[model samples]
Target chain A: MSPPESAPSIQDKLILLVEDNPDDETLTLRALSKNGIRHRIEVVRDGVEALDFLFARGAHATRVGWGMPTVTLLDLKLPRVNGLEVLRQIRADARTRNLPVVVLTSSREDEDLIQSYGLGANSYIRKPVDFVQFMDAVRQVGNYWLILNEEPPGHVP
Target chain B: MSASLIVPLALSASLVVAGLSWWNVVLHRRLRAGRDREEARCSAGPSPEEEQWRRAALEAAGQADQLRLQLRETQRELASLSYSISHDMRAPLRGIDGFSQALAEDYGDCLDATAHDYLRRVRAGATQLNLLIEDLLSLSRIVRAPYRPEEVDLSALVAAAAGELSAAEPMRQLHWDVQSGVAALGDRALLDVALRHLLVNAWKFTAGRIAARISFRVLETPGPEWPPGVPVYEVRDNGVGFDMQYAGKLFGAFQKMHVPEDFPGGRGIGLATVQRIVARHGGSVRADATPQEGAAFTFSLTSAPAGGEPPGAEVALPAGRMPVPGPGMTVPRHPTNAR
Candidate 1:
């Protein structure tokens, strides 16, 4: 666990990206930047880090300046923990249950897609192989979560 | 008077002998008639027990066919599962692609000639991965696409394919030989995809020729497994054909007989798609090609029975029932409670 005092600053309307791979994290950020999304973005490299950030524990214990992010772009496959397990925990907790979780994974499997929806995923998008298309999909997520969609009471500080 | 008495005794002896011979003939005839009646009763077709056995054997064969169909369904489900697994493989590939592109774009001048070459190789690998991912996705989609049977004018289908090809290269001169009113019973969209793949193959392989001819017509002969008069459509082209030895690999995904330089298009997914669509409609495909001469692709089609769900139809989840907190949330199955 990271030191509790050095909590990363939390801000409203932040997009929390839960991705284990650094390459995907960078690509996702690049895609968001290309789409003109400038809202504060947080990157957690694994499922455990994501849980720590959302629940305000471990290194993020003092992250009380802002509420939870407007949306979480989660990848299903992760190291330390799986994305599905993270989502299950999020839905189980009272504070982050209503948070919008957009599962942006590279999985095109019907089981994963349907099960994500069944488990209360706000939107499910399979990452496109083409960077240009991936950029467009990321743009839509930004638009929907940051601009169009209304914030849940828990997410708004 | 004594001589007359002797003549009368001789006549009486001759009449008794004749009567005995006639009775022997009548008894023999009655015995023969009774034997013929018994033989006819024994040889009157099969017995009732044998008839029952024959019926049971036929019923068993029918059940076996049904079981085969169920097996096919299970295979399709397995394919869906595998496709889901492949989805996870794309993540690292994208990371490799994305970071390499970023490195090239953001820090190009910092690297020398050797580094640039390495970066270029990395980009090339990423591009290849992208192409593979696209093919994989489309192939999965072809396996799962909806199918609805209707009368498809194959002439129109070929024409549409040719129209697109010609549209792509308007200046090129090509001749088309399409049979009129050639129709089949299948999903029209799927037939269109199959025809496009075949036609595109023809157009691609014939790129070296000055003037090439492509034909679309129905084969008079049926496939080996199909009954007589079952329609088999052929797409023949005068192109740089492949050897007969490699024909077996034609319908396999990612199977290539020619280099990208020689064929110049596609990643070997066209024929696989054609095969899948044709099979879903209860048909088969066969190819005959001669190296540096020509090739002919024949595909047959038969509509599926009514009320049969298409592949991947079972995977559709009811969207409305996923209960969120605000609205449209109905069924509340706790996903995490494994106990």
Candidate 2:
């Protein structure tokens, strides 16, 4: 069971953040950094970009020599392919079936909550309007998924 | 050829006969109206009674159509307004609050005390607007969300609200008297919201009392508006009550009677939401109070009445004397008290 020669080491934990709003993206990054998490976070602007990055298709076709992300912070409302649809495709594929996905969005609608869980989201956190609470929520999410949660074995495709 | 075929044939034949009879009644009414028209033509003009009936029917139909159109328009506007509030307005508010916070934390030493105070005010204003937006959304949700009626153990709802209120402020010495076995036929979640608001209102107003008292009990005697045997729930508290002259303004949104210095928190949307929920259940709510005495809110959820209880169940019990219904008492009796 030797490691693949071209694959990045397991010590390099990556976070895939799929968010559309730039302000929310900056705040989230700041929150994670404030919590002392130094993991390399890859930001995708929209649902379409998120899919390309995750599936290594379209603009990300030449993406190589990297392991699957440890966790994906997905936002629900997006431009082309919404977060729910992206999540569906991720679960549909065998390569990223067990990738831990946490749905972080501004929607507190019951339908969104139910549908996200129905589509196999690992966690759901509503973006609080209060900045302090938002920071706290992000802190908890980062602490749990990055440091506490045991990751599934990486599937290199 | 079998008995099943014969039974279905008989049932269908009976249904056809019933439908035909109903049509015959309709035909008879039409024929009578035509005959009356002919008689009017042969004589002078249409009778006053017939003219009045026709006008009333036309007016009712027109009013109904107008109301339906208005309702549709309101719903459309509400959907758009809720979207803008949740999606459009909240993002900017977040930015304001978040950037202000960042500036305060990262560059506090560069700013003077007055500048720090100004930033604090900006954050506070954003936070206040956020709460108002949330409350507005909640009020809209209560109006738009589907109504699901079922047997709700009101006693349990009150006690749970009381528990939460007490847990939040454990230092307060408040006496609770929640009547057990008080039930209602309504949406459980909506009923919980209404009950919590009422309980919270009582809890907030009764803060200054050394021994604050909050009680929830059902009136045994039915009011004039309620049908016989329908229970009217009352949430009473011993606190500083508002003047009855201003009671009309109490349930309106953003109508605060008490000063913020006296009773902090609450955007004054709770009672309006409570009123909306009760109206949805084909019920009504009213408030009664004296300046120094406490306030009492009585409401009736009479759309569908719960099963008939032993008449004496509404008897007021001593404080903290609740009979906690056990798991064995799980089967809640559905509404059977048909008026």
Candidate 3:
């Protein structure tokens, strides 16, 4: 049997990044770093990998200890499983039900925004095309979710 | 033998001459017949049946060509727009702006103020282009989005829009005179969008008024252009209005009547979008305004009569102050209101 879960510390705060485009991934990394966040960011290239990393299944099963990241930066357009489906699964499971998933996408469609909120995303941010605005947005998201906001209680199996 | 040959030759010559004369007569008869037919055609013009057939064929062909051209153009436009949205034309711009920022941040010590200023300009240009792209996307979406039609309470929509705008600027002394029970059969979401644009436009233009008065009510008499029994809804505001000379340009995309200094933050897309949505609903929209008095817009929605007096029963106000058709706001008198 696995050991009991414990409260995560600020120093050990991890960020799960679900992004497909290499350019966006790089920009996001730069933006986060600009916010003075030195936390480890686990980058998954697609939705399938995102789920695998979060559930500790497939390639991520043998990692040292399985714990939810402080927040998940999820991109809506992904390979295999889409962002909305990933969000649905996250909310479906008891273990990750309350995990803070922030939808980061380039879509400004009303339908996409409505669906993202409807599916229980903590926040939906449309990535600004301008770098300065993009940086500011990412900085705010990082500061708010990582430093300011309180995390929900962890699920104990 | 000589006598016999001469007699036969003479007989053959006579026979040949007779045959030639008969052929000439036949040719003359055919030419006369042709001339008569030509003259008859000239005198009578074309037969009605033949003329109709020819006209129908030409018209159908012309229409088909026009439709084909239009279809091709629409397809090309929709394809390019979808590609732009899905592949994201903004990505390249982001790359430019992001890398520029990166350069400035990483190498600030090496660059002069002039160089830094150049970077700022580049970022600003990229940001402006981003806004234009967003506006273009919205315009395209309005055209390409799937339409859903439903019964909409327009009075409620206007009241809600006004409430939101008033809440945004609670300090502004605004008076709203919105008539109740204005219902229409149309797409609720799209109609709501139109109402927002119209009301926001009114709210924006009315910024200078000490006690701004805006009204939403039915025009008692619609012009002859409108079909009978169709209710013409009017949204009027007592604010700075445009000259009637430029009224023709109001609904054009990116067309602005006012200078940026007087009124800013308008991309000039709101009215164009309103026009497109109303046109899509099979309706017509028109506007009239004086330079300083105010602007009034009257429009009719397609399909079914909307916004006449409520059939029976005093209709309850939809969670807002009842629209009093107050006389304080004197909109320019229209020609049709002579009665």
Candidate 4:
């Protein structure tokens, strides 16, 4: 049988990208761009900024018309606030509890994975070192979360 | 005429003395011949069967010596391999941890959240890898450390170990029952390591319990006793006991009775370390438990010689008048109670 038709690409979905590194951010965006994923992307430098963007706190407080992103890509290590704590807060809050939070890190440690899962991370992914591999990971994650999966309506809070 | 008769009598007496001396010589010669004959009978040439048996014994002894030499060589190789793994494996793990940390520090603003998450995981994985390497190294060191046996006040060590465990998690309610004057002859440091591992196991196992009870005591073996030697020190706990079937494998490295999710935090190296330390001291450790009941770890160590004397002495009473039996000191009335 012919390969199943690709589901209608949900290219308009928004993705909240939480990263602290410039090179990684650029690399990720380039990978997504090359994959022809036409989605609105929001970049936050650290866990604190990501929390603010999601909760409309601090700098995002004035952005009154903002909506929740379709998915959040979380890093375990970040300045001022860490990824595990952010995931904990997200899961603890009823408004964001169901929001898909993917833990993407370079850590291959079992403890991190266990802790991340314990804290209710939706998915866990390890960042590859090779440039081509990294790009492939980005594309697959983008395609899966942005196009294939369905998310709830954006929350007010 | 009378003088000439007296001279002839003296000559006859001299001839009698000479004859007695010749008889004594002949008797000595006969006794010598009899002794030689007996010796010859005893040392007669071995039978063919006996000769074959002697040759076989010699061959077996030679084979045994060769096997022993091979065993020694194998042990040496094992030690060397452990050393190399402990030392060589750490450098790469350090690089992973260090570089991950550097990456997070040097580039903080350009990446999106997803990339940052991935980097953080890398760092955590590296740190965890490093910890495992360190634990394995410590285990190897335990195996290699020279075992110097001496009198060790196990009771005091138990108390001290409990105190340290309590300090680690002050909020937990832990009850300790350690008998005083319980001593054993062992490498004090190694024994301490074993006790600490057992105590830590108790602490971790009882994390969810409302009230945790831990005990350390010395039990007297009742039977026809062997040569006076090392005494046994026991550490028991009323915690999340494991199934009895897996008790035999408890001391193996990386042998975990519970899942990581259930226990949350442990590398499962503690009991393995205890086993290594005990074995180095020429002791053996055993575990008995029922699921959800509790676990008791019993180990026998050569009791440190008393009075600074050598081992192999008869047991003696404590110097002071013996006090009435208290809780753990008394022999249990029932067989179940003994456990």
Strongest candidate by DockQ = 2
Score each candidate by Cα lDDT.
Answer: 0.68, 0.74, 0.71, 0.64
- Tens-digit lDDT track of model 4 for B194-218: 9999988888887878778999887
Chain A TM-score values for every predicted structure, listed in order: 0.89, 0.92, 0.90, 0.89
Model 1 agreement with the true structure over A64-119: per-residue lDDT tens digits: 65568888999998889888889999999888899999998887677788889888
Better of 3 and 4 by lDDT: 3
Q: Which ten residues in a row have the lowest lDDT in candidate 1 chain B?
A: B330-339
Error of 3 at A31 (Å): 2.2
**Could you give candidate 2's per-residue lDDT for residues B1-339 as a string of tens digits?**
112232233223223322322332233333345444545554455567656644543443344344334444554455555655566667778889999999999999999999999999999999998888787777766765565667789999999989999999999999999999998777889899999999999998888887789999999875776656666899999988889999998877677879888888978988988887776565668998887679999998753344533211222323333221222221111111110
Among these predicted structures, which one has the highest lDDT?
Answer: 2
Off by over 4 Å in 4: A1-157, B1-75, B108-110, B221-231, B302-339
Question: What local lDDT does model 3 show for residue B7?
Answer: 25
Question: In model 3 chain A, which range of ten residues has the least summed lDDT?
Answer: A2-11
Candidate 2, residues A4-90, lDDT tens digits: the string is 665556568999999899999898898889889889888999889988888888897755546778999999888888999999999
Residue B221 accuracy (lDDT) in model 2? 79
How well does candidate 2 reproduce the true complex, by DockQ? 0.61
Q: What CAPRI class is candidate 4? A: incorrect
- Candidate number with greatest TM-score: 2
List model 3 lDDT by residue over A84-143, tens digit each.
Answer: 999999999988999999999887767678998999999999898878789899999999
DockQ of each: 0.47, 0.61, 0.31, 0.01
What's the TM-score of each model vs. the native? 0.67, 0.73, 0.61, 0.47
Clashes (candidate 4): 25
